[model samples]
Target: MSTISSASSSTTTASRPTARNLGPKPQDNRIPVTPAVLRGIFASSRTPLEERSISRVAFFRFTGFLLSCLGIAWAAARGRGIKNSAALLGVV
Candidate 1:
């Protein structure tokens, strides 16, 4: 291969993903327009009661995430491994 050469084999060997090759940083996914953040986003424009109302997208997404986590936990408790639990969840 281009990366593995005969000269290198005659001297020192190279291993991939070395110390300096740590992958990209994990992304902290903060929702830009979630229901909870609405109060802060529209604090000046809207009344407190109006800002308290939740966004439909945010509500569904939060509920879905919560339910999916609960289902995975339940499946794991039943002795199903991650792969199997994920497959079972796909069917559900």
Candidate 2:
């Protein structure tokens, strides 16, 4: 039947990858480790502790700023709300 023929063609097409026709493959172990690449890797690997120290400092500063803002907003709101209530009660 036509259904069986189409299914067989679809299976054959799907099983073949298209990359095989692109080009010849390069050598796997022939990659050159140049001086710049070596230096970049060494610098990246050596800076983890320094990066952690900088990140901690930045986090501490950010948290302190957020806490200060929250504290200021809370104090302002509480003060205004209490004043309004006291004024309504004829106490201020």
Candidate 3:
């Protein structure tokens, strides 16, 4: 039982890959950008036309920004109300 467990553990550890085992990473070429490249990058062929089937990341980011704006507005309103209440109590 002990030998079997040791063998299984060794096999599992050996099967796992190290960073050096993987080859070098690919480098991006962002130094020289022309007008054409900029247009291609911004308006690629894969650009979604329909609003309902847009990229998930873009959708989430937009939603997060909208929610943040709403939260800021709510906090500002609440803070103003608190200040008014405090001022009224102080006057009384």
Q: Which ten-residue region of model 3 has the weakest summed lDDT?
A: 83-92
Candidate 2 TM-score, true structure as reference? 0.39
Residue 82's lDDT in candidate 1: 43
| Residue-by-residue lDDT tens digits, candidate 2, 21-89 | 766568755768999888677668767897678779999999999999978866876876755645544
**Residue 24 error, candidate 2, Å:** 35
Candidate 1 local Cα displacement, residue 35, angstroms: 12
Model 1: per-residue Cα lDDT over 1-92, one tens digit each: 85568767755645545677786666646556778587566676877665556465678889999999998778675775445555656754
Give the distance in Å from residue 67's predicted Cα in candidate 2 to where it truly belongs: 0.5
lDDT of 1 at 37: 81
Off by over 4 Å in 1: 1-54, 80-92
Candidate with better TM-score, 2 vs 3: 2
**For model 2, where is the 10-residue window of minimal lDDT?**
81-90
Could you estimate the TM-score for every candidate?
0.32, 0.39, 0.33
Name the lDDT value of residue 32 in candidate 1: 68
